[model samples]
Structure formats: C-alpha cells, structure tokens
Target: MTTTAPPEHPPAGSAPGSAAGRLWRAGRAPAAVIGLLVAVSVLLSLGSEQFPSGHLEPGSPEPDGARALVRLLDEDSDLTVARTSEAAVRAVERSGEDTVLVVLLDHRLLPEELDTLAGLGSDTVLVRPSLRSLAAFAPGADMTGRVDDERTLEPGCALPAAASAGDAGVTGELYTAGNGVEALGCYPAADGSGLLQVAAPDGSTTTVLGTGDPLTNRELDSAGNAALALNLLSAEDVVWLRPDVPEEVGSATLWELVPAGVRWSLAPLALTLLLFALWRGRRMGALVPESLPALVRASETTEGRAGLYQSRKARDRAASALRNGFLERSVPKLGLRTDSGPDSVVAAAAARSGEDPQDLWRLLYPSQPDPYTADDEAMLRLADELDRLSGRLR
Candidate 1:
C-alpha cells in the first residue's frame, strides 16, 4: 500500500500569504502618519508668534498728562507729593494740619466721601478739576461759580479779570487746577475760599479739562498750561492721593489659569495609553511546538469542556461523566446490558445487588434533583454494594 503524508501546519509568526496577513504587514503607512504629525507641530510652534508662551513684554510707559502736574508739584511746592491710596485717607485726615488733599478724581466722587471732605472744616482745601469731583467734595456748594453758564469760549482766553485781581497775592486762593479741553468752571466758596474747578480761562465752562492731558509729562509742556500747573502746586505741603484703578480680584497666573483637572485627566489617560503601548510592543515568545507529548494539557481544560457542554445543552454527556465509574463497577456484578435502555439497566442492577431499585435508578438515570435535596448517603451505599458485588462475580 502507498503511504500518505500528513497535512503541513503553517509556520509560526510567518505571514499566511492571505489578505489579512498582507494588510497587517503594511506598517510603514501608520509610522509615516505619526512622524508627519510630530513634524507639523514642531514647525508651527517655531514659525508662529501666536504660539503658546510666545515672546511678549509689558507695555511701555504711556504718556499721562497728570505726570506733568505731579512733577511740577514735586519741584515747586514745599509740598511732598507722595502717591497714596483710599486706605490712607483716614491717616491723612487724622494728621489734621491745613492739609491740601490733591485727589485725582477721574470720575465724580461718592456723596459720602464728598460729605467727609466738607466735614473736614475750613482747614482742608479740596481741589477738584472736574464738576464731578467738585460735586464729590462739595455737593450743591455753589456750582454756579464753579461752572460757567456759557457753552463755548475762545482759545487762550485769560482767567476772569476779577479772579486775576483777587488772587494776585493770595497764598492758597487757587489751590488746584487742570489744563485740557474740558475745563470745569471754577467758583469761589461763600468764605472767599477758592474752589478752582478745572475749566477754560474763558467765560465758557464747556471746554472743561476732563482729559488730564495738560497734567501729563508729554502734553504738559505742549499744552502751555505751565501757569495753571504752578497754581495747582501752590500748597505748602501737598498730598497726592492716586487711588488704584479697580481690577479683577484673585486673577490667576498663566499656570494657575490653565485647568489642572483637564491636565490630570489627560495624564491618567496618557499613562493608560503608554501601558497599552507597552503591552502591544511585548513579544509573546516562539509559537511553534518543539515536540509532541503523550497528551497535551490546556490551562483551562475542565472549565472550557464544561462551558462547551453547557453551551451545547449536553446534559446527558455531563451525567455520563459522573456515572462512568459506577457503570464500570456494576457491569460485572449485575451483568448489566451495556446496550440496554437506562430503565432496564437500573432494574437489573437493583435485582442482582438487592439494592433499592429507586437508588439504582437515581445512580443510572440520575433525574435532575433539587440541589438541596440530594440523597448523597444512599448513592454512596449503592456504589459500595455494586463495587463489592463486582469483585465477587469477577
């Protein structure tokens, strides 16, 4: 007879020469894609100024008109112009000398602060450049003189002829003033004290110096308001109260502003991804068998076999496994017919061994019983008798 050859097994890890194997072997494309993404990110960050952490510097000093007035006061007056805040107001008030509180009121003051100024008595000279500021220091305190009735005026218009004559030798008659387009109207207090509202020298108050450009260094020299600047610095000891502009409280730094929660979440996700990558990169070792053994042992043989039986609904096959030993012992003792039906086999076994027919039936057929109601002792006794009888007969 001619010998037949065994079918060849596929080589371990070698491509099977199939469509799936060919697709899996094509790995260069994905590597190229990953390399392209990294290259793009690097190029963009290098070329673009708008990239994160791009070069940026704080803004250069802006031209502030108020700085001119501040410099003038610092130079001309016996006044020591020191920047102060709202917090220092009480301290300044407590000092209680004839204090010239030169407050740079950008907008109108609150009624309460204005009242506080009024309550300070005649010892205090409140020089406000704007009607709003005047309103703050002296609410309804004769704004008729502080603001001119006329709406317009000519340029280079001198102060009222009367004001020039009156303040000729007066010490603190013109306490503070501003030089700009929108000048607040100046007025004399009932006691002849000067409340020099920052207005144009002309009769018209409409050109009030709302823009403090004349006070700033850049425009102060250009605006030709040096005389007005000198008047504002007339006080012997002037206190410049520059309240800080209101800014958002508790603003975060660049690092603090970035959401840490998202970063932390991404970190964990990246760590998990790295672990998956390591798992994927690891080799599983050589796949081919070195030699054949008497029997091959599977790691989960019992569990896999049970699962297969369960999935196939093979109850009879499962019961056959349990009864295999019993059937071997009983065959000789009872001369049990191997090809007989379960009922006939069990009846013959009971008659030959003089055991309970029901017990023998349970051992052979094993009708599904309540898990809690199993007759374990009876089954054991039946097995023992069958074993003893099988030995004697043999």
Candidate 2:
C-alpha cells in the first residue's frame, strides 16, 4: 500500500507565526468553541446559586433541610448542631433543665448510643425514628401507619405544641401508643398519628415527631410548621443531632496489613525503580526525528516483515498474511464487497482465476486443521496460488 509522505520532522521555529502558528490556526476554531462552551458554563454557574442540600440538616438550605426551622429556633434558643451520637450526648449533658435534645437520623447511631441518649432523660425530640430508635426512645410506641398524601392534618391531640401548631404538613410516617403505655398521640391520620408524646418516668418527655417534612426548609412556612418546630425546640439550650456518614467501626493500618517481608522490600524496590527511571528516561528535551530520503521505499517495510516471518518459520501466519493481502487487493477489483459472504468471495475468486470452486475454497478458506499448515512447502504452495489468483484478477 502507498501513502502520501508526511514531514519527517516538525520545522524548527519559535516564532508566533511559523509551523507552530499554522498548527494554532488549524486548531483555533475548535479551541474557540471549547472556550465559548467553558465561558457559557462559567456564566451559568455564576448566575445560579446552589445551597447545601441534605435531609433535615440545620445548615442546609435545601427543600428537605431544616435550615429555616433552625434559624427560627436559633432566635430563641442556644442551638447546637451535632454530627455524632457522642457529641449529641455531650451537648445535652452540658446544658441544664432548659435544654432539649432533638435527634434526627437516629438510625446512624449504635444501639448502645441510642440507649444512653434515652437514659439521659432530657426533654427529647426524635424525628422519623427507626423501629430500634422508637423502642429506645419511646417503648411500646410502634409505627402503625403512614400518611402517603401531603395533606395538612389537624392537631387532634391535647399536646400543647401540637395544638399550638394547629393544622400542619405532618404527612409522613405515623405511629400508635401501646395499650398500657401512657402516651399522647397527635395529628390523627389513618390508624395512628403523626406525633407521639411519651413522658418518661423521670419527669423528662420523649416527643417522637413521625415526619421530618414539617421542619424542612421547603415546608417550614406552610400551615403552622414554623410554630410547631419553634414551640418544641425553643429552649435555653437545644442540641440538634443530625448524623452524617457513619464513622469507620474499627481501625486497621494498610501498611501493617502487608507481609513483613513485602513491607521491608518496598523501600528498596521504590529506590531501585526511581534510579532505573532516571537512568533510562530522557534527560533533556524531546527526541529529534531522523530526516527521511526524498524518494519513498514502501517495499522495505514489506520485505522486513517477510524476513521476520521466514526467521520464525511461521508458515501458517505467512500463509494468512499472503491470503489477507490478496483478498484486500483483488476482492475490490472483482466487485466484491468487503463484507461479502465467504461463498461469494470463494466463487468470485474461482471465476477470476478460472479454477475449480472446491480447490479455490480449500486454498482461500481451508477446512479443519488447514492442510497448508503441515509444512513450509505447503505454505509456499498456498502463497503461490493466492499470488497467481490475485495477479490473474488484476
């Protein structure tokens, strides 16, 4: 195959409008398109403001975040946002009777931490508690129902906070008090209610608000949501615990995990690799290309590959190379499509060479174990046949 020769080396120039300048001219349009896209992206990004978003988070200004309620509570209460169960417990302990511990995402805490928090006996609010959290915070208070719709439910119970809040967007998980459990259920929906107030034996109250929707930034202003959140959380000190990604349970050193022998070898291995890189790498600038002869010599490449095949005694591979070259050149000349079926190729090849179709098929698309692969002479014979056939077609 022949190819138009490219320059053996890039012309040496440092000027702004030399060989490099032409390259720049060729590429500037695409670069300008990319630049415009980047500019538009930057402008769009600048025009839009993204608020930190998280579910019922105090600092997040997203629809699900409690930032609006948090700000309201911050006005009246000394609010502390804690990301860990340990920190939440500590925050509550530091405060007096005027403090209320409000725990969100209690599912992130361990069973022991939940029990310890429950044991604090502080006026607490559990938001969307898991069954385990429910059992720890308010025993015998089971999640009995769920409010699928986003309707505003009336405060049906006599809880001061619920009543003051009036009708609220408490459309979320619902719960029920056990038969003997002395608890007050509020905002009745379906079989259960959205809020369960259970007074601890130690004079502390555990208020389980079934849904977090009412406290989130998006719904805080709708129908007494702000009032209810403020009423429950307004205290001298309020500890708002919103758990983050759970901390690693246990610690293990990655280096220590490796075998002692392997670990000891790593230092020397790294040093040797660095030294080897420095020794073998290019010490200065880029490689200079060798100048090409004015005349092209394509046959040199073909002869070099032929010599390699002969040295390795790769008869099967040599036969394959011969057949592939003939097919590539003759198939197109024979008006056969590159993707034509094997039968069409075989028939066309047979017609062009004036040979029997079966013999042509055996030569071009050999059957089981390939008869030509037996020896060098057979491979030579196959190559001769393909070359003769291709010559005839030409």
Could you say which candidate leads in TM-score? 2
Q: What is the lDDT of residue 80 in candidate 2?
A: 92
- TM-score for each of the candidates: 0.34, 0.54
Evaluated against the true structure, the overall lDDT of model 1 is 0.46
Question: For candidate 1, lDDT tens digit of each residue in 343-373?
Answer: 7766776676677878666555656762212
Number of colliding residue pairs in each model? 16, 0
Off by over 4 Å in 2: 1-51, 247-394
